[model samples]
Target: MRNRMFAVVALACILVGCGGCSTQGVARQFADELGEVALSAPPTGATYYLQVDNARVIEDAAGDVDMPYCYDLPAWSEDGAETSVVFRTARKLRDGAYLRFDAALLRGMISWEEVGYDELPDAVREVM
Candidate 1:
């Protein structure tokens, strides 16, 4: 009986832990859904691609800490739509590096990650 209980608990834990997994398929689906919406309208959410360029450093005067690097950059959507977005990071991003951003109108940039040049869509690659 104890062995069976342990097995069931282990299975439940594994299932719960995997719930937060973010796969490429999930990101693609999210981008696809958001792509259908017009960019002029209030952004629900969407994926954006951009190449790193200049950044503005925001200093924290309270103490010597990691200052956030901010970028107001031109971005492209999955379908090659264009827009501007502002995002921040603790460290300076490498010049010419490509990134994928999950963003909303009100929220600005929700999350972002560096990606290889090949991951960029054809439209973005042409301009970047």
Candidate 2:
């Protein structure tokens, strides 16, 4: 009887511990919003730009790592002229070597506008 009781307790502990392994509520919401914006059809003739800051993984970085990285995804509409910017998830580089698709900077995005490359943060003048 003691052995059976121990087994049941162990199972309960394991289940409780597993809860912490799941994604946080905020992270989940960020992902859902990003996916909705990214997967949605682009406005007619509009271009989609992903403006991402460095993931900030390093304590002290130098050179290009400090600059803002932006990637221009294909247009959702061929006739659209609108431009949209979406911040990338922290630590996810624009053209980094890794293949991560689960991170985004913000839970929401702003409207389309003509934002100059130089006007971007970190003096980012280059776009990928």
Candidate 3:
């Protein structure tokens, strides 16, 4: 009878331990999935406004491929934050064209798209 009780208790303990491990594994899986979703989502970073100017055409070309045009322009945020951004484009941007820039601290400029003058914030419009 004693041996039987000991065996039952040991089995219960083992099962309890396994249950804890299973819970931990589930939590870990959830965390991993959340991290992946965060990484895959688009960057929610600062947006800056600027106007396209003359591009510094890249002279080096590989084979017959068209060289990229580089632009180093001053950018401003809605709150009047100022910064300089340098980026390359496959083709030249129209001079005096306004653009919205998505930027991250570590990644610099993430992307840019042309926007109408009216779309710019009042602070950005005032300066430009």
User: Which candidate achieves the best TM-score against the true structure?
Assistant: 3
Q: Between candidates 1 and 2, name the one with more favorable TM-score.
A: 1
Give the distance in Å from residue 17's predicted Cα in candidate 1 to where it truly belongs.
49
Per-model TM-score, in order, reads 0.57, 0.24, 0.58
* Models ranked on lDDT: 3, 1, 2
Supply candidate 1's per-residue lDDT for 89. Answer: 62
Tens digits of lDDT, candidate 1, 8-81: 99999987787568544554454443332223325677787888885443334343355355556777888787
Per-model CA lDDT versus the true structure: 0.67, 0.39, 0.67
Order candidates by TM-score, high to low: 3, 1, 2
- Model 1 stretches with alpha carbons more than 4 Å out: 1-43, 55-67
| lDDT score at residue 31, model 2, on the 0-100 scale | 42
10 residues in a row with least lDDT, candidate 2: 96-105
TM for candidate 3 is: 0.58
Pairs in steric clash, model 1: none
